[model samples]
Target chain A: MPRQVRLRRHPVGALAADDFHVVDVPMPEPRDGEVLVRNTWTSVDPAIRIRLAAVAPAGYFPAFGLDAPMDGIMAVGEVVESLAVGFESGDTVWHTYGWRDYAAVPAGAGALGALGSLRRLDTAVAPAHAYLGPLGPMGLTAYAGLFDVAELCAGDVVWVSAAAGAVGSLAAQFAKLRGHTVIGSAGSDDKVAFVLGELGLDAAFNYKRGAIEDQLRAAAPDGIDVYFDNVGGDHLRAALSVLRRWGRVAICGAVSQYERDRPAPGPDNLFQAVANDLTLRGFRGSSYTDRMDDMQRDVAAWLRAGVLRHRETVVEGLEQAPEALVRMLAGGTIGKTLVHIA
Target chain B: MPRQVRLRRHPVGALAADDFHVVDVPMPEPRDGEVLVRNTWTSVDPAIRIRLAAVAPAGYFPAFGLDAPMDGIMAVGEVVESLAVGFESGDTVWHTYGWRDYAAVPAGAGALGALGSLRRLDTAVAPAHAYLGPLGPMGLTAYAGLFDVAELCAGDVVWVSAAAGAVGSLAAQFAKLRGHTVIGSAGSDDKVAFVLGELGLDAAFNYKRGAIEDQLRAAAPDGIDVYFDNVGGDHLRAALSVLRRWGRVAICGAVSQYERDRPAPGPDNLFQAVANDLTLRGFRGSSYTDRMDDMQRDVAAWLRAGVLRHRETVVEGLEQAPEALVRMLAGGTIGKTLVHIA
Candidate 1:
């Protein structure tokens, strides 16, 4: 028997542990061309809250059905049984089936636009769990957002919202490493210290203190050239006001809106895009699978060189995955949040 | 004395005649490096509503002061005196000083980012009034928005909101002429008829007739690739829902938000941009003056070959400029709305 988490009910407002239930289920068999994975480390991303809605936003991942196994989450594990070619019984791997102990997944199929395709993990480059963070989707997200979507120009002034979170920390560091002026904004003063002291951003602010727009204006007196948006709503509004002419906003996620009982209307000042010749581009890490190799190569090299840093708030068991997600969404955890369920 | 239409007070809700007053002022004399012109035709654009606000959206043309000459409007006239270089008396010209019978304008000064700068017009290509419609700012707006901002790709199904109006009509026609399937959405059935019949768009819809989203889906059964957003709000919401993967939105203007008593929140489904890899880029025609020569060259040729069709909604005098704007904003008129002021 294997343990798994199921959606007990859709979250009404802030996600609570009561919204999910842990269940003991019989092991699933690997079909032809499928591999059985014993999930060891599963991701707890703020983006998952979007799927917990009754009906997910249009063009997003489908909503999680009531009393069903949660899927489409990133996980790293060991291949237990292989009916698929090129997969060995003992190889470490990553896939898009998580919040469960074991999964029977087809090798060639892609989840989240090939970002979560079943692939063998080169643990030589990084640890198995690293595939769930710095060397994996988060890394690709930060990389593609800065270099690909925002098109980071030389001498650009960059700002990362939720700067101590999974994707934000990496994006801020990448810009800093590239010798650009980088500012970070986080929910707590502790996270702001982490951004300034650990991640080494040029300026870091605690967004919980005062008016976001005023704080951003104070941090960047002149204005920002690029905004990596992880918190939508008021955060986006502030960015719109502080962004200079021809500014670019890479809309990675809207964590602030995800936990709300109802969807918040988008920023009122989106008209600023026209006023300042700005571009507000929304993107997902999964959308940029083509950049994964470059991201892994550079990020892994940085990690080995002690130039790139990663943090993970780990939970004890599969049953606590729901609690882990709630913690992550509330900004209670810094950097990546994960569940360890051998 | 030269008569000018000056702002009496900023409009509330909908623009009324009382918001503007016609005043007879002392005739302006050309200063050094200036041209004094007797204005002939002036433009009444939906975008002008933005400047009437207490503070216009940032990076936009500054808000018009109470009881001041409404600057930044496009007008064509004949130069009565040329104290500026390269300008001879009796030469036809265009400048930003509109809502007036006479203007003394500097030669090299720019307004609205140089889009409204004083420039001599080649009247032989088209009449002076045509410059205000198909050959002037409207044309540049349509061209720059489609080609530069949206980056229209081949086989792109295009949607233009406010499709029978000044900039919309030209954008729709340009896409149609370029052999792409174009859909036009207007407020009234007659305007829909104008879009389908006169503009030759592939599909046309009356947005007021049904749910905007459903109407857009019905018009573009297969999702649209490019959206020229002249009307922002529910119209933008409809576009976000119906736009396909990798779709693009050129935010040329947000007329729907301009006249509101207070600002409106942007579309709720802007997260669709991340889900579908969409890009929303805002721009003004003046932002791309370098494209002017190309636009004039192509548009002038089309006008000569009898392929490019244009219609003008003419108000009798400068005194009616406010009324013209009111009519245009209310969707009471089609194509270009102009005031014939001598």
Candidate 2:
């Protein structure tokens, strides 16, 4: 019997515990291009909330049917019975299966084989959970934003919002490695200190302390050339004020106002895009999947060479997934929030 | 002592005739490394109004001083005297020496020479006003926005705002040439009729008559792939609502709200960028000035061969420059508005 978490009802505002329910199901055999995966761990992200409500209905995979399994990106067990040629029994892999004890995944699903390069993750570089955090899609979101999207070059000044989050921490390090002067903003003084002292950011500020504009001005005295925007709102408006002419903004996420039912009151400074000839590009790392092999090769090399680092906050159990998400959404969890199923 | 117009004072809101002053002085001769140009025509654009307010203090050129000549893209006469050896007597040219009766332009000051293939204007294909309209920066702005900035391709559907304006009209024709479906919106029914019935636009509407969203939805039923934004504000919000996934918005101009002394309302649908993975790039035609040889070459060729068409609203005399700008800002003029000095 497979125990599955099913979406019993659609969420309107914040998701409640009753939105989902755990149910038992019978296991089924695999098809020609399918493999049965025993679920280990599932990855939860804010984008999941978007999938639950918005987006074109026909374009998205239909919502967890009433009384059916809730689907998501999951780290899975070896293929017990595989019709697909690539897998055999006892092999550990990841697939976008669902909130379930067992699932039948078709060939080529999830973040692809891109997640498996962590098999050789070095303890000296980053813990295993860090791979799922800074070195995973979240980390890559920062990397692509700072380098590929913002095109951060040596001697440029970089400012990152949500500085202690999974993506922001990695982005700071990447900017530092590229010889950029880095600054960050976080919700608490402790996280600010972590970014400044531990991560070696040139400057860090607690956004909760004062006005975001004054904080940003104090952090980036010279001016900001690149901004990795994870928290959009007043923070975005503040960054716009001090941005250098021809500045580049890499918009990875807008977690600051993501939970709102209606659009938040964001900055009125977008006119700077014209006055300063600025480029504000919103990038989705999923679009750059073809470059994953190259990213893994380069990032692994960087990790081994002691040029990069990552951190994670592990919650031990698939059952704790909901709680971890709540903690993450509440801004209580630091670094990458991960589930370690045993 | 070139006769020039100077910014006497910044306008509080609507620009008045007293905002600028024109003075007649003896023309100066070219010195070392300089070329003397007899000013023939000057472009009156919406951007000039932006320059007058000193709002956007930082752009390609320095801001207009409290009391100094406003220099921008201008069409001028040949070097009557040659201190710059490259340009000799009677060589007709165009340069950036605006708000002036005569200018001692430095060598390579908007210097564009004819390419061998381009058919030089001989009062046959169109009027001389075409150079300032479809054959000059306005044409290039449309071309670069459509082909370079947006990377629009054939079969792609384009939704252009301010469709009957100089750049927008050229953009519609250019998109048609590229085999793309083009839709446009203008302020009045006459402009809409001209764009749809005369210019061969796939569809067009008068945005002033009704809600922009309803008009956009009806025009672009399949969704907008490329949106060349000229009129920002509610039009931009409407475009964002109808843009397809991964749509490209070429932020060419925002003439709608340029007159405001205070900043306008924020784009309410900005979150759509994340949802659709859209790329919004704000660009200016001046940055790509090196392409003048190429643009003039192609545009001139197209004009002579009747492969391209354009319109001109000529306001004769340098004194009428302010009136031309006023007309443009009020959206009363179609195609390019030029100040013709006799």
Candidate 3:
């Protein structure tokens, strides 16, 4: 028997434990072109909060339907039973599986391959959980946003909002390595210090203590050439105001307004984008799926070379997934938040 | 003697008559590597409205100091005197010049040129002043925002705000020519009708009379693929709500909040951009300077073949420049505004 967390009903606001039901199901044989993966580890993200809102689908995946499994970015266990062509028993993999003990999925699942590695888990270079963090889609997101979209170059000054989060941490490291003067904004003094002192950011600020505009002015006196946006709203406006001529802004997420009942107010300084010849873009990891091989190869090399590092807040057991998600949403966890299910 | 309008003082809000003063002076002689041009026609764009709001030493043009002329896009008379290597005295040319009757500019001013007479002016293809409208950077802003930045492809459905304005009008036409289904919104019933009846937009709405969200929903029953943004604020919010997953938005300009003293409320639907995996971008014409050659060549061809069209509002004389700008700011004009100084 496998325990499954089924979406009993769609949620209207913050997700209650009742919105999902943990049920035991008789193990079934895999059909042709299908593989059963025993879930090992699942990841929690800010986007999961929006999935529970039941308003409309937000972010990279489809809207969740009532009484159905909510599947998204996740890492899984071995193929215990496989009727699929390529997958074999005892082969560990990853897929977009709902919170469950087991999953039977098609070969082409969620951005599993693009998120990180599924074939081999390397604990030496980076922990298996780090595979879901810096070595995963989060890291790839930072790289792609900085290099491919923002066109970051040496000597550019970069600013990052939500600087202590999964993507933000890696982005700052990446930008620093690229010879850019990097500054970050975080919610707490500790987080800000972590980014500046430990992460080696040129400067960092606690956005919670002061106005974003004033903080930005102090951090980037000369102005910003690149703004990697994770928290939208006022942060976006602040970034827009301080952007230099022909600056580039890469919007990977907007965690600040995701949990609100109504949409958050958008940045008010869009006019400056035209006046300063700035470029603001919204991006997703799926768009760069094909580049995973290259991204992983490069990231793996950087990790080995000690150029990048990551921190994780791991929650144990499958039953704790709900709490982990809540903590992540409340901004209680730093870096990447993951649930390890044995 | 040459007559010119000089910036008398920084404007507080809307430019007043006292903000500028026309002065007469002896014509400047052609210096080495310079040409003396008799001014003919010039352009008046919405951007100049902001430039007039403040006095900075080298804000608009470094060469134009205190009590100096304001320079912008212009079409000039023959080169009365040339000292540069590549120019002749009788050559008809265009360059960015001040609001003046006569001027002297460097021969190598990097002005836009006709490619082997490929630049014959057309009236049936587009309104005459469209030479600066869809035929100029306004048109290219549309093309690049749609095809380049937004990466709008064939079969994509488009939603354009400020549909009758300089850039949005051309965007609708450009998208339609590429086999895209186009929907547009305008402030007036007449402009809406013009977009649908004359411009052949698939559907058009009067944004003033109906709720922006409701109108957008009715116009785009199948969801919007691309949003050409000219009016930010509420219009942008509506566009964000209606945009489909993976939709692309080109941030062309924000006419709605252009004149406001403070930044307008942020769009409530921008978070949708992150959730839907949408791409929202802000672009400036100068960033696409490299594409000017290709765009001009193709646009000219499209006009010659009657595949594209534009509109123009000619104010007659340079003295009427202020009024033309006022009309544009008040949303009274439907197309490109040009001032003939000859």
Candidate 4:
């Protein structure tokens, strides 16, 4: 038998561990063109919360059905049985069949699909779990947002919110590595220290310490040219206030308010986009597939050069997946939160 | 003597007639490279209200100081004295020295500078006041917002808010001329009829009649591809709800809530931009100077072909400029409101 996490009920406000159920099920058999994967690691991303609503937010990610096994973003596993070409038994793979101990999926599975298109892992370069963290969609998101969306210029002053989180941490490092000054904001002093010390950001602040605007003003006396926003609400408002003329905002996520029952009021100063000639553009990582090769090359090069680093917070076992997700949403975990299921 | 409108005090909320005081000053003489003009028409634009705030909204239009003669967007006049080349006496000119009877400005003034760079008017195609109405920044705003910002395509379903106002009316007409289905919303029944009957929009609704979301859904059941937003707040929220995937919103104005003392909460569903892959860009007419020649050519051709029509509400005399602005802001005027000054 294999174990998986299923949605017990739709969450009302903040998510609770009880909203998810751990279930034991018969192991799935690999059909033709399918590979049976024994999961090693699974990811817990905050964005999946949008799909947990009773009625999925219109036009967003598809919702999970009640009492059904829920799909998540990333999973690292080993092929135990293979009935598909290009995949062999005992090969390491990464796919989207997450929150479960095992999955039989099409061998071509990529980000959101089955295991058929599953990417073969090279452990010589990095560990298998790295594919679910710094080397995966999280890293690609940071790369595409800063380079492609924000068009980060050399010597630009950049501010990133949620700087200790998966995407924000990478974004800050990428900006710094590209000859730009980086200022980051995090929820706690430890996270702030991690951003400034390990991440080597130009300046870092604990948003929980004081008003984000006041702290941003002090950190970057000269206003920021680009704001990479992850936490919405007041952080967005503060970024809007400090963005210089013709500044750009790459709206990545709204982690702070994603779990709320009601949508939070948007930045009141969004009208500033008109006055300052600013561009506030929202993009998802999936839309930038064309840049994946470039991102993989540059990020891997940076990692080899010791100019970039990766971080993850790991929890043991499939049953702990719900706790990991709740803690990630509650800002209790740093960097990427992953479940070690083997 | 020349009569001009000056600011009595910074408006707190809705503007009052007393907020402006008309004063008579000695006629000015043109310096070398300067031109003196006798104003015949002045434009009352809603955008000017941002300048009336005591503390200017940061990075926006500059605020008007107490007791200082205020400058406005457009005015049509006859050059009475010319000391600069290209501008001759009695030449019809258009400049930003509105709300005044007479003024002397440098001959080389460009946009966002002193009043000297007054544009020479050609009345062969239309009347002089038409320059401050249909052929002015208002019309250009509609043109650029549709073609440049929204990138409106043929057969696209479009929605325009404030559909009976100057820019909104022109935008609806332009979208229709391009073979798109246009739906519009206005504050009053009469305005709705004007949009549907006069503007020939596909469907029109009085936003005051019912919830904007319900009305918009009924009017555009399939969904809208482009949204030309003039009135912000609930109207913006409604548009976000019904905008189809990859829809674009040209954020031209927020006349409905611009005069409020406290900044209004932004659209609750702005996060939809990420899910719907929508683009919401804010732009000012001044940024589209390079498109002016094209706009003039197309608009004139349309006017000549009877494909486009324009409307204006005229209030005689410079002293009535404040009242005109107040009325326009209050949604009491149907189209462009101008003070006919001589």
Candidate 5:
């Protein structure tokens, strides 16, 4: 028998552990053109909380039903059986049927906006779990967001919100690597220190301390050219205020509004975007899958050379996946949050 | 002595006729390298309401001071005296010293985001007041917003809010001229008729008749590719809901937010921008004066060829300039609003 997490009920206000539960199920067998994957590491991300809602935002992923298996999560696994021509037994692969011990995946199929493709992992580049973070969707998001979406130009002053977390840390480090001024903001002082000391950002601030506008202004006195937004709401408002002329904002995720029971109204000073000739673009890592190979090539080189640092907060055991999500959404976990199953 | 309109008080809620007072002042005389102009036609715009507040949105032009002449208003006049080498005494000039019978202006200096440069007008394009409407800032705003900011593409389904008003009408017509399917929305049924009948848009709707979302969805059955946002708030929310993948929004103005005494929070569903990979760009037309020659060439040709229709609700005298603004802001005027001085 294999086990998988199921949505117990839709969450209210902040997400809690009781919203999800793990249940045992029959072991999945690979059918024709399918492969049986034994899941090893599963990702816990802020976007999951959006699925926990009774109704997800329109045109986005649909809401998870109660008492049902949760899919569309990123996971790294090893194949035990293969009925597909391209896949072989004993190969390490990444799939989308995450939070489960076993998954039967259709060969060469992609889901979740083309991010979760059933593809073999290159262990020569990094470890299997790295696919769940920097070398995978996370890396692609940070790279495409900076170079493509925000169109990071030479001498741009960049600001990355949630700067100690998985995506933000990578985005901040990438900006620094490009020799641009990089400012990072996180929820806690410890995270802020990590961004400044470990990540080597030009400036760091704990948003819990004071006004985001004042802190951001202090970081980039002349004003920021690009804002990588992981937290919406007041963070977005502050970004709009501090962004210089022709500034661009890459709206990745809004952790500030995700777990809330009700949707919050967007920034009042969004009018500042017009006042300053700013562009606010919203995107998911999945939207830029075309640039995945480019991202992997750049990030893998950096990771191997020790130029791009990677960190993780691993929660042991499959049953604790819910807890991992709860902690990560609460900003209790730094860097990437993952569940490593034995 | 010359007469001018002065801001007697900051307008509250909706603007009123009494918010301004006409006063007699000493006639302006040309100094060395300055030109004296007898002002004729003055323009009324929605952005004036933004400045009428105690404080304008940050990074924008400063608020209009109480009991002061609004120097940044656009006007077309005849130069009566010139000490500047390039300008002759009888030159037909368009200037920024509006809402007055006389103005002394610097020869080539610019103000108000480079939009208020004193320059000669070519009445061969149409008439002096046409410089206040189709051949002026109104035309520039529409052109730059569609082509430069929104990045309008071929085969893009376009929606222009406030489509019967000054800038919106031009934006809608520009999109229509490019052979894209265009939808126009206005506050009243008669204005909707004008967009459909006179402007020849593919679809037209009165936004006040029903839910903006329902109306927009009905007008654009599949989805809109580009949104020219002249009216924000609910109209923006509706656009977010109806925009397809890779859609773009040019935040040209938010007349809905300008007249309100208190600031309104933005769309709750702006996250749709991310979900749909949408880009919302905010800009003022004055920022694109570099495109003025291009705009003048195209729009003047359209005006002369009778392809681009220009309409106006002209106030009889300068004393009614404030009333004209009030009417325009209230959606009581069609196309462009202007005060013609006798």
Candidate 6:
């Protein structure tokens, strides 16, 4: 028998472990064109919280039902039984099934068909959990947001909120690699040190310290040209105020308000969009699949060149997945939060 | 002697006649490449309010200093003296100089050099004031905001705020000409009737009658694809709530908040931009100079065919320019507000 986590109730404000219940079930078997995978690493992402609501907002991601086995975005596993043409037994693979001991997946049902195709892991390059962090949607989000959405160019001053988080870390490094000056904001002094000392960002600030506007002004001196917004609310308002004429904002996420019962009011100065000729555009990683192959190649090369770094906080066992998600949502995690369940 | 209106003091909240002073100055002789024009009609535009502040926001239009002659966008007059080629003494000229009885301008300096080159009025199609209303930047703004900014298509459902004003009236007609369903919002029942009966909009509402969200939902039962935003507070929030996936917004103005000592907070559900994949872009008419000739030709043809109607609220005398501006700002005037100074 294998254990799986099922949703017992929809969360209201902040998530609690009781919202999920662990259940024992018979292990799934591979059918025709299917492979049985023993998942090794599972990702805990903030976006999954949107689906935990009773009814997802229209046109957004679908919601989860009570008493049903929950699923999320990324999982790394190994094939134990292969009934598919392209996969072999013991081959490592990444899929979109997680929070369970074993998953029976159809051949090439990659990222649960949301990310197009399933990917095989090359253990020689990095560890299995690395695929769930830097090599997964987090990396792709950073790449797409900076180059495709914000249109970052050399000499541009870039600001990334949630600077020590998975996506923000990569975005900062990528901007710096392209000869652009980058400033970052984190929640604590330790994360600020990680962003400034380890990530080698030009400047880093603790947003919890003082006014975001004052910190941003001190960091950039002039004004930022591109703002990669992950934490919304006051960070967004400060960015709008300090953005130069024709500044561009790539709205990646609003993690600060995701768990709140009601969304905080938007920035008061959005009218600045008309006065300063600024552009604020929102995008998701799913829309940029056309550039994935190129992005993967460049990121892999950068990883090998020591220009990019991958960081993860791993918790043990399947039962801890809910706790991991709650911790990540609480803004205590430095980088990607994952659960190692073998 | 020529009578000119000068700024007495920068306006605080809403404009008042006390903020302006009318004075007479000795008539100036035309220099080389100069022309002396007796102004007949002058435009009172909402955008002029941004410059009346003692210190305009950085990167926006420059501020009007105290005691200096105040100038606005478009003015129609007859050239009384010409010292340049391609001009005659009696040629009807349209320049970007206004709030004055007479103006001495360089023959080639059109619209005070802010509207690109100078344009000579052709009175064969309509009256002289028509050039300042529908045939001028008003029409160009509507044309460009729809086709270029919002990318309105034939089958798209469009919502235009401030629909009885100069730009909004033209925008509604232009969208209809392209076979789109147009809805409009005004501040009064008469203006609502004007939009519904005269402009022939698909739906019209007075924003003061009910909650803007309920009104918008009732009008656009399914959803809206394009929003031409002129009133930016609650109206913008309502539009955001009803915009379909991939909907586009052309932010033309925030008239409701422009006169406030502090701008109102923006739409609370702007996060919907992420879930709905909406695009909100701001633009000024000055950026669309290349489309002016085509717009003029099309508007003239529409005017002659009786497909387009020009409306104006004319206040008489140079001393009344400030009164006209105040009336227009207070939303009491319909269509373009102008002062007849001749």
Name the lDDT value of residue B37 in candidate 6: 84
As for candidate 1, its clashing pairs are: none
CAPRI docking class of candidate 6: medium
DockQ for all candidate structures vs. native: 0.82, 0.35, 0.41, 0.61, 0.83, 0.58
Expressed as tens digits, the lDDT of each residue in A1-342 for candidate 6 is 788888899898999888998899888988999889998888888888888999876667678889876755578899999989989999998887788889887765544325625567888877778777667678888898899988887779999999889899989988988888999999999999999988999999999999999999999999999999998899999998899877888888888887889757888888777767677777777667777777778888888898887678889999999888888888879888889996
lDDT of 6 by residue, B158-229 (tens): 999999999999998999888889999999999999999999999999999999989988999999999999
**Candidate 1 per-residue lDDT over residues A196-261, each given as its tens digit:** 999999998999899999999999999999999999889999999999999999999988888777
**Candidate structures ordered by TM-score, highest first:** 5, 1, 4, 6, 2, 3
**Per-residue lDDT tens digits of candidate 2, residues B1-342?**
457777788876777777778887677777887767776777887877776666554443455788766766456454566677667766565666766777777764332222111112334534555666776678778888888778897678999998888899998888987789999999988899889877889999999889998988898888988899987788888877888877888888888777787777667667677656677777777656666567777777877778676777888888888777877888889877888875
Candidate 6 segments whose C-alpha is farther than 4 A from its true place: A6-12, A16-21, A29-34, A82-88, A106-113, A116-126, B28-34, B82-88, B106-113, B116-119, B122-127
lDDT of 1 at B242: 95
Q: Give the chain A TM-score for each candidate.
A: 0.98, 0.87, 0.91, 0.96, 0.99, 0.96
Q: For model 1, how does the per-residue alpha-carbon lDDT over B54-165 read when each residue is reduced to its tens digit?
A: 7888888899998888888899999999998899999999999999999999999887788878888988788999989999999999999999999987999999999999
lDDT score, residue A197, model 6?
89
- Work out candidate 1's RMSD over C-alphas: 1.4
Please give, for residues A1-342, the per-residue lDDT of candidate 4 as tens digits.
799899999999889999989889899999999899999998888788888887765777688888886765578899999999989989998887888889987865554422114778887777889877767788888998899878798768999999999899999999998889999999999999999999999999999899999999999998999999898889989988998876888888888878787888887877777777677777777777677778878877887888887778999988998988899888898898889988
lDDT (C-alpha, whole model) for all candidates: 0.91, 0.72, 0.73, 0.85, 0.91, 0.84
lDDT of 5 at B328: 88
Candidate 1 wrongly placed segments (more than 4 Å): none
- When 2 and 4 are scored with lDDT, the better candidate is 4
**Quality of candidate 2's docking, in CAPRI categories?**
acceptable
User: Estimated TM-score per prediction?
Assistant: 0.98, 0.86, 0.83, 0.95, 0.98, 0.91
The superposed Cα distance between candidate 5 and the true structure at residue A175, in angstroms, equals 0.8
Q: Where is model 5 chain B poorest over a 10-residue stretch in terms of lDDT?
A: B107-116
